[model samples]
Target: MIPKKLASSLLIVALALPGCGLVLENRIERREAAAEAAYPSEGRFVEVAGRRVHYVQEGRGPDLVLIHGASGSTRDFTAGFMERLTDRYRVTAFDRPGLGYSDNVSEAYEGPFNTRSASPAEQAAMLHRAAGMIGIENPIVMGHSYGGAVAMAWGLRHDPAALVIVSGATQPWPGDLGLLYNVTGSSLGGAALVPLLTAFAPEAQVERTIASIFEPQEPPPGYEAHIGAALSLRRASFRTNARQVTGLRPHVTAMSRDYPALRLPVEIVHGTADTIVPIDVHSRPLARQIPGARLTELPGIGHMPHHVSAGAVVAAIDRAARQAGLR
Candidate 1:
């Protein structure tokens, strides 16, 4: 016969599991509403490969394209770069697939969590088609962080006018991404924990993550609200982002081999103090690989150089424009 205490404990666990699921469901609905209210899509969309790619186009001059980082959207540009660059260039910023307002590629996972469309090359292909649909051709491509990898793929496949990489994950880094990425990115973890995070992760935790990303410099006032931190926590975004980050290294390895052959004028900007994508490991070696590539090292700056040093990024863009004779 089963002991009364053991049976009672088992019954409680069974009841609590379903109860937690119910709470999570309600939380997701509430959070989704809050997220939409916080950052309504201010951009237009173009369809490519059955996915709606969200993009914001502004300014009027030589065409320029901006691709944002991991867990980021076109709003990252709107946070600062879009306004500053719009005055001189026809700037278009795109939300990477499975992020922001962009439609995710539909696929059933063989395991718990993974993706076939989370690669930089695939994202580049999608955005390239969208660019053509929107009447942009041979524009300068600027990518920050993970977007830098996509920009590289764009240059390889579609021949951009120039390439600007800011704190880009250009080369393979040593070791794994440690516990946070592994745990969140795992199949079991993603399935079980992502919804919980999306439902209940505090705004303060989001603020802390943002602050950490821009370490050595604080987020400007209203940045947390403007950047739509809640959007990143959405279950779909969380899974897609995790898969993308987890699968990045292999893609970058193959992409790096082709860098030496790239003749397009490349501009690489990185901060010396950036721990995210170490300067020595990524940008420095990348600058050397690309023939005639220019490297600008900003002392004391961190990963979010696009926000921290917009002038420098703009200046680099100008140089690329001149080199490509877009001016």
Candidate 2:
């Protein structure tokens, strides 16, 4: 009973949809190429269980391992933070699996529609194996933001000498992570929308996001260039990061119960003004959970205390080393 004109329009629209998808996929690939070329890997890789993990190692004293936050790579540390510690301790900064140059924890998680992510424990174990391969033993482990959760998992499951959490997301927050994570982590968004973002999300918007993460303070000159924000925009990294962050709360909630059992030296540094992971919600409660944990509160600093207040972070690390008898 349909009119010929209406049927023709429907057919045309249906035909165009596939063409549009092809165009978008092509754009995504090109953008990924551009990003990779602009910010090539700056470190070596170690293969663990058939997957590659990228890391930058420097310094020569006691071993120290650094884990970066969500949407970050080892570049987050090499962007100057590592330089501060290289004189005192042997440092290794790792690109957590799926971000930066590292491979996803599993090939199955690389599919666009798949929403599963590597848990903090799994990430810890994989990185620990890589550390063992590198001959790093009883190193002090430090994590920033999302990396903090992985560091905590490392402390619990492995035998790190000490731990330092810089603006870490260690405990479960009260609310959901909002629309960006909620949507991008869903199956439909991961499949249909991530390509569009990969192709079209602007660099200015990324700069603004970087600025916001350092709010109440500004990113140091050249920080944007060195951090390589675009690297996280690739389709697989974007999907994996979103899925990991969205699914993190349950894991952190489960991990909280084991904090009291940890006997390692623990040092936590957080900015009072940090909106990304509030001091009251994460670091303060975290300091209370672990026995003999030291908490340093940086007033007027935001999420990036390691950059803005590098001295304090380094001091905390030194304290942790001393407590663990590494200093």
Candidate 3:
């Protein structure tokens, strides 16, 4: 026996919910359209296991595969850093699955409430298949931040000439990934809050996040515009990134045990001041794990060593090529 007033209130709330959902969906669609228009795909696509993988290929020398971090695209490399190496080595930059213009690994993984994400190994396998389609084989693979996990997976599952990890999150760290990832990655948050973020996240906030990622150093001129930060704000990209980052520790823990088995030339570049992926926790232990792995520590630099200290990164890559007997 429901009271008349209570029943009326419940009915009104139920009626309003659909309209609210409609508005949010409309806004999300508009924002996604604007983001794509401003920063369209900068490279061609190849089909890998029935999914589209976007990549940019340039220069001519040894095959070099570049994997950008979480929420990043090939644009991160194409911005300027890839150009620096073009004269010496052929470079191919890829947008990891579920980010940039690359399609999600599967439709099941795209659902807002779905907790499953493409693992680093899965991403590596897909991209490896795509690389094969484009004739890239036994090449030097480099990964930054989250992409480092994928690069390591590539090395373990397949053969690569060399590996360069920049500010990589290689080992499992203490504690969880904090509120943003934990919340956004959850089933409830992904379905309810993600659309709000996608629809209303401001440009200034994106700039601030970019600055934080490059903390202890400023982002280079036009870096924000070139990196296509807007792409990361789309509902799907945001949800997928949160899911991947939140669920990464367990995968890394499993992967870390296999690090000692890697027998290829490995170069690790990390900033001593990096708080995002602490050097002491990730790079230091990683340097000790791999056989004959070389580590280059940049004092006072932050997570983005490739952007802040491109010369050092290039030097490490050169050293890797030489060590691998490719030079």
Candidate 4:
């Protein structure tokens, strides 16, 4: 009964849909191949709450747990920082949920809410459970950027000996994460456009994006190769990170209100030149709020203090361990 013109249009769309799906599948395979080639898992996995959580463990002393920021893997610490901590502490670095080699726990969240991805709090719970599996008791929990938010969540509910926040997005920002995150985080864009980006975005573009995150200072030599930036380009990782970031504001707002209850030692390291997670907006106010919290400002450094200013981060950890009476 449909008009001839409309029937023809429907047929055209139906034909195009399969072709588009094929293209997406081809893209996904290529992207996944690139990810595996560049960053094969360098850590062990433990089944935590029905999901395999990837973690890197090394050294022998007081336990220390490292959580990488959004879109980063355990390699973020293995690149260089973990060595510094291993000499005095057993360092275990984790890839946040839905990132790197860690299993995506979005659907496995225990809460009553229906959500596609794990929130920061849920991620903290999963990682904390992973820690328990490995016998990490009251370890110093450290998080950078988005991972910092999860660390705070852990400290609020758990009994971490100390909390170290490095360039953490502790406070909620006022506005959006610009156009890229807004569009990619939405359901429509995530389903339609993420595959195209994963399929064909040039490696140069990915390199450029990583460089920008370490702004005010060029990425350390061989940084691109060591960090496995391609892993971040996978469609699943891209979509999960976009969702985590887009939904972060309210979570940070809710968590920050409970900052006072975190009575354990807290060490915060931030860069004055960090435009990504502005120091003034997050760390400074955090230092003022947490009683006896210490804030160390890295002059002229950008967002990645763990890379650019390794000694300061180590010192903060030392101070925290000492304060927690673990050293």
Model 2 lDDT, full chain set:
0.90
What are the TM-scores, per candidate, against the unseen true structure? 0.92, 0.94, 0.94, 0.92
Q: Model 1, clash count?
A: 0
lDDT of each: 0.84, 0.90, 0.88, 0.84
Off by over 4 Å in 4: 1-18, 108-115
Q: Tell me the deviation in Å of residue 187 in model 3.
A: 0.7
Write candidate 1's Cα lDDT for 1-327 as tens digits: 112343344334434576577766887889988898878897999988677999999999999999999899988889876898888898999999889998875454223455433678888988999999999978999999999999999998899999999999989989997655665577755666566667767777678789988988888777777899788888788778878888899999999999999999899999998998899999999999999999999999999988988889999999999999999
Candidate 4 local lDDT, 150-268, one digit each (tens): 99999998889999999999998877787666656767556655665677667776787788899999888878789987788787787788788888889989999989877899999
Clashes of each: 0, 0, 0, 0
TM-score of model 2 relative to the true fold? 0.94
* Candidates, ranked, TM-score: 2, 3, 1, 4
- Model 2 ranges with Cα > 4 A deviation: 1-17
lDDT of 2 by residue, 1-327 (tens): 112343344344434566687777787789999999999999899999999999999999999999999999999999889999999899999999899999988897778889899999999998999999998989999999999999999999998999999999999999887766776788966776666667777778788889888999999989999998888988888999999999999999999999999998999999999999999999999999999999999999999999999999999999999999998
User: For residues 167-198, what per-residue lDDT tens digits would candidate 3 score against the true structure?
Assistant: 99999999887666776788976776667777
**Candidate 4: residue pairs that collide:** none
Q: How displaced is residue 90 in candidate 3, in Å?
A: 1.4
- RMSD to true structure for each model, in Å: 6.1, 6.3, 6.3, 6.7
